[model samples]
Target: MKKVFSQIISLVMAVLVLASTVSWTVDKHLCMGRVMDISFFAHAEDCGMESAIATLDSEDYQNPCCEDESFTIEGQDHLKLTWSDLDLDHQVFLVAFAQSYIDLFVPLEKLPVPNEKYPPPILIRDIHVLDQVFLI
Candidate 1:
């Protein structure tokens, strides 16, 4: 009886550890940059042959704290992302939002990693973040 109870506790502890490990992978798909606003969302599709994906547009949300008139991807700058743009509907917006989500949340060891070959301020995934500021 003692051995059995010990084994059960061990199994339960293993299961909890696995559960917590997985939970750690779930984090925010955050972005920061010149965009007026940024947001993220996701959806999965069954096309039979290929999966369909979508993302939100950054322009749809409120503007950023500020903006620079000139923005370029090559200058090695980071940009915030939002879930919408102008009057465009959700479908169109989702196309980009999906990619952003993957780039923001998924891990390098997991599916859907970022394409770092392209540029700077690259996507950050499975991140732990806190919003704190210090004033001097």
Candidate 2:
């Protein structure tokens, strides 16, 4: 009876820990309440490819793409995407594989941005190579 009771207690404690960690991850890394006004999806659209790459790299909600208007002050730290950021072929690849890249980083429903009721078709068939490069 004591063994059974200890096992049950351990299970409950494990579940509670898992739940709290998930909640904390969603709140902190994903910037849940702080950026509620901005939809992650729309923000992605506005930020585009570089933002996609940044999101994949950080796995957090740090405005992967920022423009002049995106900040209240001028010269605010922001991701300035240039062709130099990625090679020519990679630039084309970014367009080709953007949605897949995003899916790897964030769930569709969790995307902070608003969009069409239906989800878009997945474009990139496989991202094994990209996984090696970006998701290290």
Candidate 3:
């Protein structure tokens, strides 16, 4: 269960990093103050008003009733970090932390058993029979 939980947490963190470093755009088309279409990562389709206005005489050209708007969200562009980028103190701390973390999982030395080489004493008589103690 702990292993599964750690895996899930790692996956979530990876996704979070990916999302922070990714960029996207949102395109919207509005006609007469009402949203006509909304799209992602692509241009929004224009309403029929644009073509109708284009066909009119150039001299009488005026702003079309429809409008197109776009919003671009830029994500982190510099994600490459190197060891040299860290300060000496930070590097030392990181090294110490890593060493300690590794040592945390190191198996402890096996303890010596006190009587591993000793054999059990030989039974000469039935001690349970000699004693009056009996289980009910």
Candidate 4:
């Protein structure tokens, strides 16, 4: 009876520990939220080949044809993308593979100025940005 009781207690403790660990991992691994407003006008980013070579989160979301994938950004600080994420550390840049592209980074003059008239926002299919690793 004593041996069985001890085994049961040990098993319970182990289960609790595992459960807690899993809970923590799930909480920390993904950013969970909802699109609260239609005014949430922002850029949608997709992970390219470079991302695939590095991690799995993108694989979870990106299609096999590498078509348009759903990548969401939470707030302005956290950008959730369809890419490996490099263990959730490398922040990826959304780049579109296109032809006849000359520049990836736009100049300041092209950006909307305080008093200057500007045309509609450009839909750049080919974006180029390097992943930035964060210290967690």
lDDT of candidates 1 onward, in order:
0.46, 0.53, 0.91, 0.45
Per-candidate Cα RMSD to the true structure, in Å, reads 35.3, 33.9, 5.6, 36.0
Total clashes, candidate 4?
6
Give the Å shift of residue 24 in candidate 1: 7.8
TM-score of each: 0.19, 0.18, 0.64, 0.19
lDDT for each residue of candidate 4 in 1-136, tens digit (9 for 90 to 100): 9999999999999887565544121111111233222222343343344466457654546434333323333323344545665443333223323322436554566656675666777856533333454557
Evaluated at residue 116, the lDDT of candidate 3 is 91
TM-score of 4: 0.19
* Pairs of colliding residues, candidate 4: 55-84, 58-83, 95-127, 96-125, 96-126, 96-127
The local lDDT score (0 to 100) that residue 15 gets in candidate 4 is: 88
Q: How far is candidate 2 from the true structure (C-alpha RMSD, Å)?
A: 33.9
Among these predictions, the greatest lDDT belongs to 3
What's the lDDT for residue 112 in model 3?
79
lDDT of 1 by residue, 1-136 (tens): 9999999999999887565544121112222432333222222222221111123344345433333232222221333445554457776677789888888965667566478577666656533333344445
Any runs in candidate 1 off by more than 4 Å, and if so which? 24-136
Candidate 3 structure quality by residue, lDDT tens digits, 1-136: 9999999999999999998988989999999999999999999998888787778888677765778899989999999999999999999999999999999998979977899999989999978889977888
Higher lDDT: candidate 2 or 3?
3
Instruction: State which candidate, 1 or 3, has the greater lDDT.
Output: 3
Model 2 Cα lDDT, one tens digit per residue, 1-136: 9999999999999887565544121111223223323332123123244456665856665653343223221222444668788988998888879978877876466545666577997967557765665654
